[model samples]
Target: MIRSHFDEDLKQLHREIVDMGSFVETAIASAVTALKSYDVERCKEIIESDKKVDEMERKIESQCLWLIARQQPVASDLRQITTALKIITDMERIGDHASDIASLAIRITDRSFFPESEMIFEMAAAAIDMVNSAVMSYVNYDMELAKATEEKDDIVDDYFNKVKHYLADVFSTQPHRMDVAIDYLLVAKYLERIGDHAVNICEWVHFSQTGEHKSTKIF
Candidate 1:
């Protein structure tokens, strides 16, 4: 009976994690659209919608705590609860980074042809996809899918580096644009960091199931 109860609660936690993942994905998509179209209202919308993601994170965190306290989980059960804790943390911070990107977009709206917007969007899209797969992997214990996501994360890094190297060239030739260039660079950096966090969540999920860390902090 206890095992059944724990299983049910784990399902609820996983569902909430998926919900949060959707919100994060939406935030990234909206942010990129706002950047491309120069829409301040859209930026504000992203900022306001972030509240829902925050609430979802808090609710899932509460569920995790309740499970840990009431079920007194051990072994893999304990790992699941702890994994939920870490998952929410990374998800919430990813949401925060999305908000940061939106805010920066608002500031740079009048600037001409903001640097590397497409590459940054591509990075965010890849990260969002990985975050989605990571949550699903946790729910299904799909080790194969988890392993695939680790590779996709490398693709995100490649795009990230491409933007970095391009920015280096831009700044060297057009030093007067340094301020705007730096802003765009920071947005790319934030999105790359967000991808790293998503990969971290996948590693933790894989670890929770296999008892081995999937990411060795190597990539």
Candidate 2:
């Protein structure tokens, strides 16, 4: 009976984490959409949603601690709960990055001052894909998917570099637009950081499945 109850608790914990992941994913999407549309109301909505993400992280952390204290989970079970604790931290930071992007978007005074860069949208898409894959890997306990998602972080990083190069040129040619260019670059930086956090979540997924901090070596 005790084992059965513990199993149910673990299941509930998993469900909660998945829900948090879903919320963060939506936040990321909404932030990017607000940026593209220059929708101040959407940006404000994303900022407000960040508090819910924080609450989700605290709730998950509490559940994980309670499980460790009362259930005394060992071996794979312990690893899974601990991995969740680590994953939630990364997820929370991702939420913050999304909020940061939205905050930056809201600060733009003249949207026409900055030229559109395709790389910005590409970076957002790449980061979102990585986060989605990482969460799905955790939900399904798929080590292969986790490893694959981690590998995609490089794509987002590459996009960030491209955006930086383009922004530098904009600053040189259009000094008057420097402020807007810098704000766009900051958004790119946030997206890059979000991708990094997704990679961290994938690493935790690997640990949860294999009890190893690193994913399986790829030759």
Best by lDDT: 2
Candidate 1 residues lying further than 4 Å off, grouped into runs, are 1-3, 114-116, 214-219
The Cα RMSD in angstroms, rounded to one decimal, for candidate 2 relative to the true structure is 2.6
Estimate, for each residue in 132-184, the C-alpha lDDT of model 1 and write its tens digit.
Answer: 78767766878788788777888888878888888898789988887778878
Model 2 vs. true fold: TM: 0.95
Candidate 2 pairs with clashing backbones: none
Per-residue alpha-carbon lDDT of candidate 2 for residues 65-163, written as tens digits (9 for 90 to 100): 999999899988898898889999999999999999999989976777555666798889999999999999999999889999989998999999989
- In model 2, state the lDDT of residue 208: 84
Best by TM-score: 2
- Model 2, runs deviating above 4 Å: 215-219
TM-score of 1: 0.88
| TM-score, every prediction | 0.88, 0.95
